[model samples]
Target: MTADRARGALAVLQDADGKFLCEVPCGYIVEPTASAYHIRRERARAQRRRRAMLRRRVALTVALLTVAALLAALMPWSGSGAADKPKDTTAGTLEEVHQPTAVLLPSSGTVAGYVPNAAEVEALAKLIYGEAGIVPSTTEQAAVVWCVLNRVDDPRFPDTVLEVIEAPYQFSGYDPEYPVKEEFAILAADVLTRYRAERDGEENVGRVLPAEYCFFTGDGRRNHFTTEWKSTDCFGWTLESQYTD
Candidate 1:
């Protein structure tokens, strides 16, 4: 289109389908110069890096949420930490601690008495675990708890769960230095809750005993004890201790 056309010829290349491939003798074409190609390659690489960064952020978010969910599950039902003792829960009526299910026992029998001091339930649960091994069925542990309560009720035994449990050589395995498990504490809370409620004239459907019957041991061979009945009263077979007689 100019008088300088003779100096530089313009060319247009097309594919077999007649679609324009590119223009030649121009500064750029289908096969770009090395400098143009390097710029385009660097831009593509930056885009890939951005995409990878986004994927990492998504994965990190998902992991954080999973950890949060697990922590929530392990937290106490009353929303207190383990470092916070159940003994600290001395305010008014003790809140019920919900667990997955009731502490199952092998038998339901006569266990009654005035519940220990409202503040002593946590200690009572620790005492029960101390006497009963860690693996006893919920029913077995309940029997142990009831025995302590019976002692509290009996004019013959100590007036408190703490005193009864602390009595020399009774629990045999008790060591205050050992840690109390949260599970047993929870079960203890349940037992204490029922006992306190029933004693205060509240109807408790989850009550473990029909009445207050006392005495219990791994074997009936305790030397200085008396058996009230020739037959067992629901907790397999128990022999009452008669230290005075």
Candidate 2:
């Protein structure tokens, strides 16, 4: 019938089951309502807004989880540094940006290991002199030089000051067993001793060995080869000898 009749019939149908079937006709008419359309649109809009908010929440949660997982994976290999962003390597940790120690050793049997104090130098000098029968002198420090050199190569050598000096084949102190010059023998022993010390990663022994060439021929004379002959080869040092006895 009419919209008024349909609404009245619908209200009556709500109160009683199957009673309005007798009053209503079989033919139907759809009557649209502005209030109904407005309610439907509002419900749809509310649903859409709810769905959009849910999607945004899910996306934010996923992003946070991804960032947390990445941080967890990186933390093991990563050092002390910034957050999600990278930091400057120049502003590193204390261990990373550390300065090196500033102690030096010389072939003169002087603090020729990373020994920072004067006491260590004097003790090392005495040890070199006592074992190898060499006097630790300013001019004849080659034996100390040799000992320092060899010591750097191997730390397992005799740790005693004297033992380091007298270590076997450690220094070429034993030359042709002729009546040796007292002064020369002492100087040679000193050099051999120090050469051994320098080889074992001893920072003190660095740059202490003299750049000078000490050449000794079979003729018993201290020889000096020209720069042309000596410049290319440190093997020229083969002539340099350290006397053990």
Candidate 3:
């Protein structure tokens, strides 16, 4: 068979319309099978693959973001907080510590006769805060309280601690309105206890200041740096806890 004859040849077909038909037998009942259909299918497959890749990228991004959020929540931000003042450090339990106060100076000799009560302790503590400004473990504060107690025993001053504190012009810083400070409160209480013990005949209870040497003043110095009196300066002021009187 020649190539041109084969292309031009046609097969005969019979129809059911009661007539003979003559036509080609090649299948072409509907659309033609061409390159366009294959192109469209390839484009659709490419779109589906792109969509799947986009979904994977979105899921990975979401997981990474979730992990970052969790890490942020779990991390502790140290070295970022409020600034505060140094808190006071007292040596004992609160009951032993935060208890109440005592004071006075007199023209004549005096000594404490009575045990200090809570109210007396409170008054004396305020007086010490007013005069001494409440330093930590400073005997200058105790000296201030001792001066007041020495007057408590003095017949020249009032008989009681409150009376001695309230006496006129004795303690220049004495503020009946002074705010109660914890340091002075404990100091006053401790001083009162020691004074009471010394009077009760207890020896060496750490009552360093002698009862006779009781008087603290901003003008006076401990051990009398310029004079024969005993003095010191814990409060940046000359404190003559021991004086001629």
Per-prediction CA RMSD (Å)? 17.5, 23.8, 24.2
Number of clashes recorded per candidate: 4, 44, 13
lDDT of each: 0.48, 0.37, 0.52
Q: Candidates' TM-scores?
A: 0.40, 0.21, 0.42
Top candidate, metric lDDT: 3
- Write down the TM-score for model 2: 0.21
User: For candidate 1, what is the TM-score?
Assistant: 0.40
Candidate 3 per-residue C-alpha lDDT over 1-245 given as tens digits, one digit per residue, 9 for 90 to 100: 00111334554343333243455534422333244556777999999999999999999999999988787555321110122111224323334324332233222222355444767777776665555552333665676676667667866567888887776544555656555555556556667776776777876655545555434434322211111122342223333333222
Between the candidate structures 1 and 2, which one is better when assessed by lDDT? 1
Highest TM-score scorer: 3
Expressed as tens digits, the lDDT of each residue in 92-185 for candidate 2 is 2334213332223434653344343332333343332332222223432343434343444444444444454344433233212212223433
For candidate 1, write residues 1-245 as lDDT tens digits: 11111225544555434455555563333342345546777999999999999999999999999987786565312101233222312222222332222333212322454333433555555554445544225655565566667667878668877887666535543445433445556556556656666676766435443345544433321211123322343343343321112
| Candidate order (TM-score) | 3, 1, 2
User: What is the Å distance of residue 211 in model 2 from its true position?
Assistant: 6.8
Off by over 4 Å in 3: 1-116, 134-137, 219-245
